[model samples]
Target: MSSATVDTPEGGFEFIVHDDHHHDDGEHHHETGTMLGFWIYLMSDCLIFGILFAIYAVVGQNYAAGPAPVDLFELDKIAWATAWLLLSSITYGFSVIKMHENNKNMMMFWLLVTGIFGAAFLYLSVEEFMHLWHIGAGPGASAFLSAFWFLVGTHGVHVACGALWLVVLLVQVQIHGLTHENKRRILCLSLFWHFLDLIWIGVFSFVYLTGVLL
Candidate 1:
């Protein structure tokens, strides 16, 4: 195939090739498809959390002679946990910015910061659960406790998985040096981390704040 040579305004000659344009379009389509698939997966996850929230809304008030939110929840601790998770989300954003700039060291450093914040959040969550359990507020204690544990525990499990994924991605960044594949993975992780942050906001507001108010 013959290629057309064109002169640019900047005095640079460009070669226009039909085959290369087609290849570029194909890659664009592939990236779009991948992101769309991930979005569908996120929507499914939202449905699961939505159902859990609905269930909790129904049974959250049923104490069955056990401790309720007012009796068990500490706003100070929950607020601190919220701060950690929120800060982790910010740090993850910084990592993405560093990734875009192709600064591997800075990206990795920000990711490490994010991971620390995530770990702190998880530790605080586990401490809350342990405190509740010790004070006779175990999951099996009542319908309310069961719902609380199921909903919050599920979110905690997601955070744990995200933290693990971050570690693997950090290794990949070290080994692969932020290739296109690695960048795509990083974008996906960014989406997942942000999604978790949004979910936690919902949990904090709807479950904790509302529970305390009622």
Candidate 2:
């Protein structure tokens, strides 16, 4: 019997549909939850980011004596940065899928691409911050600057850590293929990476777009 399929927005991808209506055969259904671990990690990350965001909301607009987002942030720079990070997510997806196929070389190639894009994203973050610092908008400048630093800086730090972790995992995967533990770790890291992308959307929309307009 042929299996069912689902339509994916990524251009007609195939997926198996579970038979919820029937259960038979000596089929040993394993309840191995990879998602639970990912959720826990996401929740913990939320706590970290939540605290930072609260700090920003508290002290974000104290532009008392310094330039605000309206003054230092540029649209073009953010657009490029967003592209880099978003593209990295796609590359990371390829790496994960390739790992599943046990195509070690292809996996490594995609991972290297992921790392490069991740690096570019981090570099752009540093440049943005450096530009602000050059314009005398340090933490000591004003509440707006401080909060801006706290929010954006916090996310940048996460991305930096993620990039570093990705590089290490690349070496580990190359040396040890995708062992069960490594697979789990990679899956969790994928969740981490994608979650950061979601948060970045929030950062861009709230911190940049809204901040500039309103």
User: Which candidate has the highest lDDT of all?
Assistant: 1
Model 2: lDDT of residue 211: 82
lDDT digits (tens) for residues 73-163 of candidate 2: 8988899999999999999999889878878789889889988998998888998888888878887888877778888888999999888
Number of the predicted model whose TM-score against the real structure is largest: 1
Question: For candidate 1, lDDT tens digit of each residue in 36-150?
Answer: 7788898899999999999999999999998889888899999999999999999999999998888999999999999999999999999999999898899999998999999
Model 2 C-alpha lDDT versus the unseen true structure: 0.78
Off by over 4 Å in 2: 1-35
How many pairs collide in each candidate, listed in order?
0, 0
lDDT of 1: 0.86
